[model samples]
Target: MPAFPNSCFQISVLLLGLAAGPGLLGCARVVSATTSAAAADCLVYVGTNVASEQENTIYLYRLQAATGTLTRLDAQPGGAAPTYLTMDAARRHLYAVSETQTFRGAASGGVSAFAVDKKTGHLTLLNQQPSGGGAPCYISLDRSEKNVLVANYVGGNVSLLPVQADGRLAPAASVHQHEGRGPHPNQTSPHAHCILPDPSNQFAFAVDLGTDNVYGYRLNAKEHQLAPAAAPAFTAAPGAGPRHLTFHPDGRYAYLINELNSTITALQYQDRQYEKGPAAFTELQTVSMLPAGFTGPNSCADVHVSPDGRFVYGSNRGHNSLAVFAINPGDGRLTLVQHVSTQGQTPRNFALDPSGQLLLVANQNSNNIFTYRVDQGTGKLTPTGHSVEVPSPMFLQVVSDFTR
Candidate 1:
């Protein structure tokens, strides 16, 4: 692939159930916030929470995709605590969950859609619907982009919404209720954190942070419904506290990150489905996020696989670092490679550029986005000296043709 040009053009479509596959196109430098918005050829959006604001705000930024500079685009108040966000496959729409608050004239949490105006880098609010749970902290669009799914942290449930022809969101077609208890004291109840559709989109998997189990949902696209998979949830270690999981591009492997134990578990997803016990979920390996001899309050926030499927990375809150690992493609195992400091506190989330040549780290507590160049050969990250300053930045995702 050739180097990205001076001006980057990214456009993201906002809708439901859309899937941006594990593999990505190449990416250039993003626009720096210090520069003029006119210098940017692509738009970037960040979700944040700050007091004295109307819920959580979505800030629009234009990135000089080639130069890596960011220009602030028009921003608007999205909803209450829009902590996590995902964009549709077409790069034409975006979806965000209201982390907490009343919606539709009640105490229900909310999820909403916005149509992306590529030319002006502005968002047109489309529609909003209750998340069926309170404080939705994570959201994902399925491969079809037809269903918008949300996981509520405090509400302990998951909701699925349908995407309309006009890019609007309809009320949830199906919702799942999680119930369980783990080892820890606070873990005595379900704290549904995230739901990810399997690569096949035939099923969905959700992790309950408090119970340390990943729940499986059978996808019924025809009727827009989700039924519990035969073995609804798979249990992790006593207190590992499963937080999130990402599947390998080949769909043969799954990697899960735990929040409490601050460790990651690598698994070999059953090569074949089962009519017996439970789809044969087995654990292959485990590794901790922190280096030995380090003691602190454990809070592992996010995790992801390198576009090539050869590497995985996870973020640690108290440790404030990214734990990198080299994945063994043959056996679906992982070898710890490196742990890089994020250069800020509480790296709420991190994103790899479309090309997998760069990394953008969002430190929510420090209000900064640090960009790092990824070494294709070694899968290591190097500081690019390019960064953006935003207020309480929480999540990052790439969009191409954003100027449309």
Candidate 2:
């Protein structure tokens, strides 16, 4: 392995209907990470919508890791427009962003905590809190599983909340409102699209789509808090609209995918800062999502670094394609490898299985989930020739061995 961030499960029979809204409830505790469950024996958890409407429910599915087969477990109704999702380290809880205009008695979007049943794939609502702003499109939990961080896109804010002992959630412990504008009229506003922590969990990075900036934060895991880093935010080109970012497993370099421009940036990491070394980078070699001369409009959504540290994948909306790239391990650079058809419309998000042998692409516009077989040795994706039809598939994540 060269260098990248070191980072660190599903179920579903019970459909816990929230009286007021969804609440988290508990089931199993992960007693051991050494369960001897093969990558092909893992469980998959997915977050989608209700009939492609505004948002009303999240469905749980069982994925046959070896075959890439999916079976719906049960559906739970809560929060509005759950555009994104993240799982706790222990696979005992789940977090989702409620991308609505209002939430938790506040005029902003919010987040929800749910208990996980590794065996049944069902989730019980634990708690809900305002994410400190509107349209909470993205959320994540620290590796310690002690804090939940949320990013409000339209509201232009980021907030942190405490996770309870039982996998429930507390109110906002800290909230930061971002300021500034980008170049384009549509992209020149503050829109915090994602909140993610580096693989080491030493720092956090938040990507803003509207302002063309990637904000970095210093984390206090023991204290359960977060603050802006000394070098606060990194600026991208005007109107780039950065959406999602990822780091190589070795932690030597990082990558960011710009939503507006449909470009990929390779960055070298040295001393916790992007340095001017062989790995140091500031601009993209090229944008890889579109077909030649077939542009209507383009927006990139998600970015992921392959487990083996040899490839990266990003999603394009209007272009409706998955851009693939090969990484030069010697110098943290990217070369456009291939562009694959998502076989559906508006692929809002995708996730790789823990074993890194499978990929799931959520097509939000066409209401379906597409699966692909991943070739670890060569960093390539081949269609599995199968799909699961669902309503407004927005976000996808894996819950390994949800059954303890």
Candidate 3:
């Protein structure tokens, strides 16, 4: 990716002038300028904690690209405590998971779908379906957009829900119950925390914090089922508590962020052998996310690789900071760059905008979302001094559209 130039403000001013000058500019030129500006803006959706007395809601906000300022848009009622949010590939539908054990008398959590209004950034409820488990914490769409995968922490399972023709969710097609335990007290049962599809779209991996394993599966799209891969799972350290996994853009490496141990493990991925054999991942290195001399309790929340694949970032909840690492392009190894404070209590989640120019961190306990400017060349984060107040912001999803 090209380095982020310093002339973004100047370019924005020029575009504004062209958009405002109808008499001097041609009609086509004015329309083009206006469309460009609209494309630069984005819509941010936040998932919040749900309380019994409080109605669960998914808050929407408008993000001004030029300044990284956020304006409250709307709060749409949703199922009980939507803790995680995801969007379809076309950006036409938004999905969120209600992280409760029971939903409307059923002994399962709920997943709801909504139609996204591109122009207003509003959401219209499409339909809701049972997630086939309790305390669903993460959701992801398959590459084909035909199925939604969910991981249930308390239920100790992973499930697949079919996506209907109209973008609504169909009843769950399959649920895989996990069994076993790890070394820690919280690891007494299988607690699947995240499920993400491999870049090849042929397989998906479920990160189980309780079992300390990342289970691989073959996505049977036709039946909307998940079958265990030949090599079913990769074992992390006995008490590492693998919470999330991210693959390198080049498809040569994979990273797992351990929530309990506060460390990241890099693995070498082999794609070619997957055709005739099971997918293979070999451990390369493990690095701590916390800074030296930090003895306080800390757990990791999220991890992401930069768009350019040159940097990796992981959120440290108790430490309240983001650990930055530089990736070795040739070897896929990581070296710690720096650890920057998140300026909040618990950064449960953070998202890098589509432009790769700004990052928004959702500090759950602090009830705020903080924005930071991404230094493209150095992979460093500088606070934008722009933040918005939200109640228990657990996750953030940003979408951009030029047609708006």
Top lDDT model = 3
Candidate 1 per-residue lDDT, tens place, 242-270, comes to: 88887776777788889888999888776
Candidate 2: residue 371 Cα off by (Å): 0.8
Please rank every candidate by lDDT, starting with the best. 3, 1, 2
Maximum-TM-score candidate? 3
The per-candidate count of clashes, in order, stands at: 32, 24, 0
Name the candidate, 2 or 3, with the larger TM-score value. Answer: 3
Q: Candidate 1: deviation at residue 105, Å?
A: 3.9
Candidate 3: deviation at residue 337, Å?
Answer: 0.8
Q: Model 2 segments beyond 4 Å from truth?
A: 1-38, 50-55, 230-232, 272-286
TM-score quality measure for candidate 3: 0.89
Alpha carbon lDDT at 197, candidate 2: 68
lDDT of 2: 0.71
In candidate 3, list every pair of residues with a backbone clash: none
Model 2 residue 261 CA deviation in Å: 0.8
Q: Write the per-residue lDDT of candidate 2 for residues 1-404, one digit (tens) a residue.
A: 12223222011101111111113322222221223323543455566656356547787776666667777777777567776788765567888888887775679987888887756768888888788889888777776778888888888888888888998888888787888888877775799988876655666678888787777666666687777643434677788888877767787777888888778788765533332112223443445556567668878888887666788888888878888888888888787777888999988888776656678899988889988877666666788777898888787766554443
TM-score ranking of the models: 3, 1, 2
**Global lDDT scores for all candidate models:** 0.73, 0.71, 0.79
